[model samples]
Target: MSPRPSSPTIPEGRDSDGVDFRNVVGILARRRNWVFGVPLALCALVVAYLLVAHPAYTGTAQVFVDPRDQYTPKDDPLQNSVPGDGLLLVESQLKIITSNEVLNRVIEQMNLQNDPEFNGERVGLGRLVKALIGLGKPEDRALVTLRNLRKKVTTRRIDRSFVIDILASADTAPRAAALANAVATSYLEEQAGANSAFQRRTSEAISAQLGKLRQEVKRGEEAVAAYKAANNLVGARSRMVSEQQLDEANTQLTNAKTRLADAQARVRLIETIEHGDAGLDAVPEAMQSAAIVQLRGRLADASREEAQLAQIDGPNHPALQAARAQVRDVQAAIQRELKTIARSVRNTYASERTNVQTLQANFDALKTQSQANEKLLVPLRELERKAESSRIVYESFLAKAKTAEERQGIDTTNIRLISRATTPENKSWPPAMIMLAAAIFAGLTIGIALALARDYFDRQDRGPEPDAVAEPDVPARAAAEPAPAFRPAVIAQHHAGRLSALSEDLLAAPQGHTMVLVQVQRAAWLDDVALQLARAVIANEMDVMLVDADLARHRTTSRLGFDKAPGLRDVMAGIAAINEVVQLHKPTAMRIVPVGLSAVAERDPRARQALSLAFRQLRDFDRVIVDGGEMGSTASEFGLYYLADEVVFLAQGPGGKSEDAAILVDLLKLRQVKARVVFVEPDVSVAA
Candidate 1:
């Protein structure tokens, strides 16, 4: 057997089969017409459009958005529904300026439907073409005219302010200006009308409420009056008659108490004089007796006469005896008068006591009546308070109703036209300069894309070389040791079974060999190819190991439903023993290692270095088949290329010849790495 070539690494640009930027620039230069002409042609078209399109003149009018009567503590309900702050209010007002109400007014005022700019007049070649095609109709024209009129009217709000601009476009400058002014005027009028209507409604509501409140006040006043009458609480200035009566009763009670004490003292004094040893002469009653006084005076006179008689005549003389008798008679008369005085004093005491009892009784009865009246006054006073409150509420509502009625006829719109629209001097739509720049930019971009696409297709048509060579698909890696040159072993469809044919190619190689199975194009039956190869190995009665290296789409693992099973990632991360994760394919009894989700394992720098050891461990098996993901792009597959002894390319059919695989083959040949190809054709059977 010929000596195996050393594996090659990716080469620098000019020395290997790879696309270079210099070549891409050259291809663009050759197709200069496509790159430059497209942009110029597009710019010409933009000029043509500007010339043929009817110029639309635009006019603008400015208005303030402040609501009227800000100090009234009332809000415009319609305005309040819109947001209140900064951009939101501005945006809402902008919508209102373009509202149907305002626009319809503008449309009617300008008679835009009859205007040619809006009504679709047949002016140019396009109109003639449409007429020839039988596309233009009167009804369609009316609808289109209305739609165009609406589209021509636009509004914008000035930033950081409460100003909105109403803009209208028309065929003539004066017409556009008139339409704009009309729209602004109509909006202002509508706003004023709305405010007036709102106030009218508000006044109506307040009037209704005022009527109810008036009835309430009347009822409250009536209740207060009825309570006052029922309780007999007639008085001056909030004080009731019963309260004054109570005061009078208290004063009488105090006076009666004083009188009763005085009467009792007098009665006791009289009793002392009559029943005790006190003298009648010492008594005030005896001192005031007229009969007693007379008796005393007479006794004194008779005593003096008896003294004169005794001195001149005998003791038993008739004149002296008469004097003595006269004195005794006077003394007896004085005694009778004292008894009469005592009886009269007792009678006076009894009469005074009776008067005191009558006064006390009268005072007590008045006091009881006053206290009972006081209890009734509580609810009556409450009724009075309610009456006052209802009166106050009624007055307040009446005042508000009057205010509302006064404001009902007042228009409260603050929206004023700051600037009226004037005739536009120039057209607004189809800005010449901006359209030209945009056309140039867009044309350049499309032109460049087409140029690159054309170059790529041309390269593809040229195809790869007939002689196969191993090449690197990855970026060039620095050489550690010089590598030998190698030849490629290209495999095509054979009469033998593709699987059995692949098996023979491997069996013919040195024993216990490792190879990477890569598809020339993606999704070229990679899983089916891997399975068939495993079965071929099993048929030969040799143990084989299948390592699924495809992390993107784990076709091998999914087909066998071993998605969750531990496989390449687990082994690489040292989380599982190789034997534990390796599942045996029952049909072929082949050992298959699944590719699990091991992002951390693939990211580690040590994972690639550990591959040699992993391959050595699998030396016990007769063969190791690694599903080396995609051909050119996968970094893991590029690393696997160095670890495997040889590489096998699986092409789907005649259409499966990828330029990427060709480049990779050339890179492999430069490094002297053994590589081969296996073509898989559809609807054909092969033998072993």
Candidate 2:
């Protein structure tokens, strides 16, 4: 048995196939013309475009809508649009700034309808291309000019701010600046007009309401007057006449009652004096009389004289009688005065009572007239209140109209210009640097893809792989697994130079089979030689198989890691089929048929016929290499030698000069099997 050679160790970051980075670098180098030419061509095209294209200048103007006041309710038109959202308000204003109403004014002011840059009247390469493609005008000439101008003008708001930016493009810097300024001015004027109109509408509305209120005030005042006249109500100093008279009558009634009470009391006093048993001394009139006073003095003297006489004489005395008569006379006189005083008092009381009664009757009549007038005063007071309210409302509306008119004249500025457009110093169209960079990037991507595609086709055009790879007859499960015990091409290619002559010495198929027999003869490199020879034959564009039919030793099978696998012995003993036993190596594209269970050839009488039948099944391959056991005296020791048309003897082993190999060689000569001796140096690498 021989030992297999050690495999080369793979470097880090590189596979057994090749280095990935080197493969990429190599592909670029091989297709260098494409890689460089494409980018240069694209750069040239960009340069040509930048040179021939029109150079347009851009001018920018900024207009600020004072967010504090622009969104206020003072202007109904602007306020009603995009309410409560500040950001949306600014965005909507940007749209309004670019609207047709504003842009049309700019067009008229700037005479853009006749400008070549905006009017579509100028001829250019783009226009010529469009014309060639039948892109004729679809509207009137002035309409086309307006559409073109609109395309050249754009409006946008600054982020998170109320400032709007207006941009215009033109063939000349001054024209561009003029167009931008015109557009800005037009937008500001439109906003101002909208605000003015809103103010005017407000004033008109106030005036209309004022007129209605004035009519209401007049009607309310008229209603109060009509109510007063209809009920016969009269007033002096804003007071009813009947009410005044009733007040005066009430005062008089109060005085009359007092007077009547005093008079009745006086009358009662007189009657009480007359009916009572009291004397005229209690009477006031009697006390004030001079006649009673004089008679009282005379009666007092007579009573004194009579008392003196009555004590001295009897009832017939003349002096006593005379004194009694005088007393009687005085008493009667006093009685008559008392009666007169009573009559005078009674007359005075009666006069006062009559006057009080008359005044009470007059007061009662005044009260009834005042009560009727009071009932009519209710509606009259309500009408007065309404008239006062209507007058106040009319004055308020009138004041509001005046205030709105004043505001409309003063607050006409809705937008202010933050920045005016200036003549640009450089062209904006056909950006040279950016275009060149983009062109270079695109060219590199396309060039790399095309190069890779061409390289893939070039590899595909080469011849197909050997039969071992073309028709892999492996099991379904083993399709994912790597080839069994297959050595890399690194080892095969390393040994290819030493085995080149040996590959030529391998005999072609004589008539029916391309089977070549090899006798190891104690060669330590038996497995290595057989593998290298098979790989070399495959590289020569031939399908080849290496068979380890040396059943006694099974060196190739043991070293190739398939010693117990089904092989020639299994095929010859009816244990396995030839297709099932053949092993295909992926890395070297070498097929090897291993020897298994050699005892079958010795014990089974039909083993020879089975072996011949197996060899016949393998006739489709271009070449078959059989590893016979060490050389021996009898041809029976090398069972596959009889089937082979050629035999190779390894000269490095003792069996090459032994008597047994000599006898076998002569027998091979007699059978006319072409035989040769190959001297192979022993391999230095240890088998894994």
Candidate 3:
């Protein structure tokens, strides 16, 4: 036989197989009445709400931000370091604006809590009902009141500017403006006062430090003065002059004493000559000269030796004896010579003695003068001490005076206000147009979803109702001839027997030769019937096979706890050989051959043609229970009706009075199917 042609492809835009934009438009057009009505009604409601809603006026004040306020300048002497951007200051200000301190002040100033309208005004019964239904809460009433008041008060940064816009709203415009202005003024005053306090404290601290510094300066000056006074430091020039005069006088006195001693020595020599030393002339000039020369040489040698031995020997060494003897000889010779000379020069000697006496008197006078000069040093030292004291006092007082002068200059001026708050003129709220547009869009989207969902759940098939015979695309040879009619008398007798006898008769059919047919009024009822029949057939102890003929909704395998298997559909399509697709249910002693398990067949036109071939291959089972599609469904009427030998129509008593059942019966008769209709009654006793 020639293979059947492939199923026709569903055209794009076709309503049956793809999204129908036209249907979508039609649904939307149909719902247009509600669409327009809902929005218009909502718009009216909004308008009514606005009309009844309390009128709120807003007032605003401009505040300039001072970023520098929270920071200390680098040059500021008293400032200490802190972290973060000065934005912290702005944040602090924001907190203060919303603080309980500010809020309480506003409440008290406006007498808001006591004002009935601003508190809890009477609410209508409609609002009460909405509140009970959770559409509203009583807390919302309080919030609304607060919001209404809040509307009279708002603070925002001005666009692209550091200034803040403080706005207020109220039932009365003036009050709203006033409240806003008041809050702004209060905040500004508070900030200004804080700044003033900070400045005052800083100034006071500086003042105290300055006072301490001044006292320190004074004490430092006094210390310097006392030090100078104690040290007796006269002016440098005066001290130098006095020291020069004292040195000059001492030099003169030393010179005078030297002359006086020279004169006295000469007189002593003259006296020795006059005392009978005329005989000294008898001595040899050479001897006298030699003696004097020797003594002088010896003394010179001894002094030189003594100087060299000063560190190692005493002045009394025996080496000095020759010098002493030589000195004595020289003296005796000098005395003799002097006596001889003196006899010849008595007048000269006497004159020498007078000069010596005069010289001694002058030496005494010089010594006295030196003593008097040394005495003057005490008074000069005293004057130096006094001068040093005065200089010290002057320096100390001068240093203190300079420090005090610097301290007194730290007064400065009071901190000044750099900016003032200004009242604002406009209100911000509602966003009516945007909200309405969003609502309309949401409503339409919801409406479309509901329509599609309704269509999806409806069970009616759309077109080309199921017919008795396969379509012309299927080969005639693949179609089965009508089954031979069974005697109604024989079936009725079998049905009237005891349930156990019926079971025995079914089981007695040759071990591998049995057939069970189940028909239902609709495709959805098959699962329950198939399960019941499957259980019953398995209980007969004959191997059973079940076939699902409902291509539109193939669920038999799933219900039998099998995943989709390539069964009857593949055999009919010639894609799979029969034995390969036929799955055996081992534990139950049953085999299940489901109809087309391919999800594709539901929309394929050749599905019925393929199903007819699948049913032809089912003769191998010992007993076959076919779960054909619903009697009224197209798949059963055209694809499965001729395949069954004996068919049973499943109904539910008077509940099966729908036109669907009547049409199914007529279709079965028209197809010449030898089927018996059975009504199922609910067993109340078993159900309970």
Candidate 4:
């Protein structure tokens, strides 16, 4: 027969034979309806909708915004749209195409106010219900139609390109195509109208400036004419009268000074000749005289005749005397002519000096008059410059105004339609394959979550399964001494089933120390039950310890064959350590701490604190079963009661009226402990 038996404990999972996959499969199989049901219903609805719903048609049109075509007619800069803004122009035109101004044009042209899809008008019961609830304020019919048109019409620019696509959706194909084309036409018309209006405004702006500029030019010219008259600045050929007179005076004065200088030089030369410092011929005045030349010629002829006669005849010769007399006569004539030429030069020099003084006076007067006229001309010249500037500006404005007027009739928007919309053959929404796939995915996700959630909650509702752990046999104790008032064989054999249940409840947790207050008067009974509970806990693979806390008699110490062992009391009194006093029972592998021989457990004031320290240290063991003796009058001795996880009140008969035990139970509320009480009645036949 097997020595080990089964005891009740909590189990972790299913039986060892079952795998995790099967366990999960069983849990989900129970909730198959949720896992498969939702997707089927959603798919059925989608299929029915695809069959019954109206088949929608989408029409598409393409517009090309030709930025390269500036279309500027004149020099007016505003004639062309912002062509330099390439990508920016495309984006701005997108907004303009969607604006109310363009959409209203389309609505009026196509008469979309009467179209059912665009009008968004509700009739019958739905309108009445909305009116009663005030869902939205009543709006103009045109506004509602415009809003619906805006919603149905879609516009997008092709990727990094100059083409824009306009899409419109409707119930029928023809109406959809017409709607798309109308929107494109409306946008182009809006752009053209914008250009025409801008040209007109520009013409008006330039005209507004023309009159003011003209007035400015007129005022400038008049001021220049008035200034010229006031300052006496009239002139000929762009020069003042004083300026011409000053030029003539300066010329005459310069010529007079030159003639005077020449006359003075000639007069000085004649005086030098008269003083014999120079010859008469050496002076130009003398050399230019006719009388001096003729006299010198006659002297030269007579001297030549005398030289020939002196060579031919003696000193008394007639021709030589005649030549001497002729030479003296010619010298007298030459001297007379030289004096006449000198007088003529002095007179000429005097006349030239007088002429120079008169001309100098005239030139000075003309210079003063000319300088005064030049000062007056400064303001007149400034006024003339202002008049010229005003005329130039007026002409510029006049040119701009003419250009603006000419361009008013011409439209220069470069946007044009490239492709017209065609009737679509297929609907855009409610794709059957995609909806079916989505429905399946959603159903699987929801079903799996619900199945797992239900399984988890069911497991929580049922309690945990009990573990099949081995139970220790309460074998008969071999004793050499006679037994006390408590019989171990009787209680161990008959009360084990009942005591095992109590021990399981008290020691549910397999870790830490549990001080169980056993209110039994008999010391032998404490030893038997503490040993029984400890041995039972050991079968579950735990370390169990026992402490004999009965102070008056150390009977449990002796029964466990540790009569001479130093124990908890000696450790409390500082006589022996807990390790030296503790004894192990070899048969059950149970450990015990018996009361020592030299210490008193009843009267020590520090006994409770020292014992609490001892219990706190014993938490290293899995279960420490404390054999607290019977309840006494003082709570100071029963301090372990506060630390106990439970209280097993063993009385031997019907539970006795022990007020000490009741008071101890009441005081346990200080620690807020929910103590488990197990009342035991001794079986008389088993005891006998």
Candidate 5:
């Protein structure tokens, strides 16, 4: 056996595949015409479209939406029960702007059905295409045209405002503006017509109600008149007669009673004065009499003259006697006047008592008559109240009816055409440079997708992968020879330089050791590489043990033509001993282990330990080469890497997927496994 050398360190430059700028440049350079031509062609087509395309002009008209005030009842309790927000009303009006009724009117007024552009029957590329496809039918053409016309006319409500912008587009500058203005005007006319009709109907209803109310008022007044006539009550004063007479009677009775009380008091005073207990000066009536006052004055003069005579004249003098006689005559006159006044007061007292009795009797009779009249007037008063209420209602309805009739003649609309649409100054669509740029970008994207798709399909139809099928009849001597002799012509030429470089380093590796060949990429061709390495070891006259560790697809075993042979899988599963699966290569005379179909070998807990023990048994051979399919792709492959002395990772080239290999390398390093990477280029010679 040869002495084993120290483990080899993979050079940093050769650790994993790196980016090859040359490869990308070669791809683009090979398809240079396609890369440049597609975008330019598309840009030219777009420029042609912009130049020759029919330019459309857009026109806009602005209209204001004014919400009409809803008639609110002044005394109704339910006026606020429903939603009356003007926002909702405004929104409703906005919807009505685009309604079928309004649009139909606009269409009729503009005579748009005869217009080819609005009817969708205009001569154009789309129409020609549809004609060729036999799609345009005459029966549905009107509907289709109407639908298309509606699309051209759009109404937009200004944000947070009640203004709406009506936009219309057409082939001609004036037509676009005309259509916009026509739609707005038609909407306004429709609203006004609707309001006028409503007012007319309302006026008719009010007139009918007013007629009924007038009849009711007339009937009520007639009934009240008849009631008065039937009771012989005349004039407006008739109803108030009983009440007025009772009031007057009460007043008269009260005055007469006052007079009677005064008269009685006067009579008492007169009687007292006449009895001589009190003087007649105490009588109010006598004092008030001018005759009594005159008599008293005369008596006062006589008393004074008498007092003078008594003071100055002799006892029997003639002047003294005459003064005495004058005083006596004045006293007699005053007494006679007081007695006459007292008798007249008594007569007035009796007369006043009789008058008070008559007034009291009249008041009582008037009160009785008023109470009876009040009872008779109860139903009449109710009829009067009803008549008054009906009259008021009738007057209100008459006023309302007059107003509605006046409004019916007047045309009014809440919507106003604040601004009319005008002829467009410039084309609204197909900005030349911008459209050209977009077309160029789209063309480039489409070109790239086509290129990638062509490449993918070409690869798919390029027959099966060279390494996908296993070779069951290749002689062992073919593998032991140089790559050109046994490998396929495609692989030999492409991998010649890489295999040559790898051979020198691999041949210098120490003998009597295990080598694990693992492919980190999915569905790789690492097994073929392992076969070549095994053959090379055998060529050195060493006893090589080639173990087909990949049980899933026994590529090595197939190449060796030992499918029926017991192999490593049997030994791992404890179904067969290690010695039982070992066989010698036909031409190379090297020991080989075929992969047998053994179930549960992967799930065996002691599979790794058993594989390690199997490796130890293989130590007697000059070298052991295990084919581990893919490292992360299979779980059983990890045990082979642990059992091997050195691991070779085969990576596919021309891709930036080194991260996957790097992760595997890190994992292997953690397990204390030494790994080296070998990059195999698929189209290396073609690229070159």
Candidate 6:
């Protein structure tokens, strides 16, 4: 049995495959010089760039926010105090600063519009000189000139600050400073103009409103006066007094008529009683006097009773009738008394009538006086109405006049600057230093990446040593010890011994030599049948020399473990003795000869010579097995046909076409080689 191959031991303090941090570090450390050098070169390049770049002179000017001129307090009635930020006003001011109005003013003041520096046309002093010397075109000079112009002017705002810095660069420092100052002055002037315009508009509006209000006051006064005059309304107090007087007079007249009617009624009542028909005037003497007096007394008593009865009862009552009977009797006496008194009363009535007429005349005079006073009140009422209307007008106008006066005097001092712009001495662009630093950083990063990539692509093997004597399809396993080296001549000796044994088995048959089986590998098809035939002949105890004749792509000899042997080529070339080339294995009783070194077999004529000599020597053995190279090669067919006793054509099953095999047989027949062809199918067990 062949000795098993040994296994390699892995070192501790390393990965399972023997890789370690030290190995990785070694790779990077080897490349450290490049990594450091690359970054340093980048930094040097940055420095060189900075040195070659144009030096710009930036001139700046400072301007105060000018609280009174730029920012004005908002007049919002709902607000009590001014807003501190006034963002809208600040934004408007910023617009004015950058506006064409300010820019145009700056351009005019500095003679910038016509100056080549600000003109859209390009021009340069260097190009102009070159043109004068006939070295440059005028248009090219103009472009250079514009480029220089663009470098001179710059403007930007400070970070979130109210300051806007205007910068100008020029060949001379003074011009740059002058340009910046001119821009700032122009901006200031623009601000002043804007404020003046706004104030003028406000003043004009207020003056117009004041004039209209004054006219309105005059018209309102006239209207109020007209209303009062039309209505004839005096003062409220005078109207009330007139109404009270009329009411008093009406009451007095009503009372006087009531009294006159009652007095007249009393007079008529007395007259009616006096003229009644019953007469008691003649019965009133002493006895007549006694009787008449008594009658008179009774009559007086009856009259009193009638007066009481009238108060207590209606005239139709029975009690009232008794009273009336007495009253009739008393009325007869009263009629005598009244008739006597009536004459005197009629005379008195005539005198009273005159008095009544006199009283009525007095009342008529009082009425006339009251009418005259009411008539006199009308003009007074008109005058009072005029006075009231004039007073209303005066009051309303007085309020307006007071408001206007207050507005005129109100102080505008609350408008003040909240923030001031400061002058900036340095420019805010082309941050070269930071850019250089970033470039250096990027170079270092690239260097590291390149190092890692280089390590990945190189395919050299690394780690622990391999264990097996032969590297097989599977990984190597541990064995007790290694196998011994093989000899070259042992293969031929084993073939000679196997041929002697086969000669013994064939003694009964005409004492002739046994049939030799010579198998060859073919190209266009794999030769599993050849391998199986070799195994079967060996099982029969016949001598078999398995000659691997595949000279191109030497696969068969390598598969048989005779890759290191020298055989057919040595004998063909006469370089080595025959016994030294063939190799034998005693344990399997198998002799095998590989086609000699790979170089000899590639030359077609030499390969054919080698095959012919090797086949001629095979007659010494009982039976020889030849692995001819693929049928595709002419050399394998020529050499094998001349040498073999009987050729066994081996083919792979499920192999492509049988044309090569059939053609080989026909070719052998044409040559009249003494050989019988036998087709062998590939054995399934051996193939698997």
Ranking by lDDT: 5, 4, 2, 1, 6, 3
- Name the runs in model 2 displaced over 4 angstroms: 1-18, 70-85, 216-397, 412-414, 457-688
Q: Provide the overall lDDT of each model, using Cα atoms, as 2-decimal numbers.
A: 0.68, 0.68, 0.50, 0.70, 0.70, 0.51
User: What does the lDDT come to for candidate 2?
Assistant: 0.68
| Two-way TM-score contest, 3 vs 6, winner | 3
Ranking by TM-score: 5, 4, 1, 2, 3, 6
Candidate 3: worst-modelled 10 consecutive residues by lDDT: 679-688
Task: Please give the lDDT score at residue 502 for candidate 4.
Answer: 64
Give the per-residue lDDT digits (tens) of candidate 3, residues 1-688: 2232232232334223111233345445544665565656666766666566655566666676655533322234334223454455555566666555565566667677666555655465556778788886455544555544554566665455445666666656567667776677666655565555655565565555555555655665465455445545323434433345446555655665565565555455555544754534333332456654565565576556556665455557554554455556665665654454445445544555566566556656656655664465455556555556555655554554544344333322222223333343443344466657766776556656755554334434222323232211122231122212222212122222213332344455443332333443332322345544555557655456677665555555655555566876666555776677877666555677766454434435355555545555555555566765544343443435455554555554433222334344455455554445555322110100
Candidate 5 lDDT over 308-361, as tens digits, reads 888998869999899888988888888888888878888899899999888888
Best by lDDT: 5
Following a full C-alpha superposition, what root-mean-square deviation does model 2 have from the true structure? 20.8
Better of 2 and 6 by TM-score: 2
Measured on C-alpha atoms, candidate 6 has an lDDT of 0.51
Better of 1 and 2 by TM-score: 1
- Models 1 onward score TM values of 0.52, 0.47, 0.38, 0.52, 0.58, 0.34
Q: Write down the TM-score for model 5.
A: 0.58
Top candidate when judged by TM-score against the true structure: 5
Tens digit per residue, CA lDDT, model 2, 326-432: 88988887777767766767776787678778888888888888777778888788888889899988897787788678778555455799999999999899788
In model 5, where do residues sit more than 4 Å from their true spots? 1-55, 68-85, 124-135, 139-149, 231-239, 258-278, 315-318, 339-349, 411-414, 429-650, 653-688
What does candidate 1's lDDT look like per residue over 1-688, in tens digits?
3344332343333222232333345556767888888889999999999988878899999998773333344544555443445466557777777777777676677676677777777477777887899986556655666677679889988877878999988777998898899989988877777777887787788778877887878887788788777767687648877667667766766766676676566557767766878866666766777777778788889888889888988899998898889989888888788777767766766776676677667767767777887798888778778878888888877776776777666665556899999999988977999998998899888888898788556535323433432111112333322222111111112212546667787777655678788765553233466666765677677778988877766666776667888887776666766677788766446688898656543335466545546766776677788887655433343266766777777765443244445456666666666676666543342321
Clashing residue pairs in candidate 4 (N, C-alpha, C atoms within 3 angstroms)? 9-467
Which 10 consecutive residues of model 6 have the lowest summed lDDT?
A: 480-489
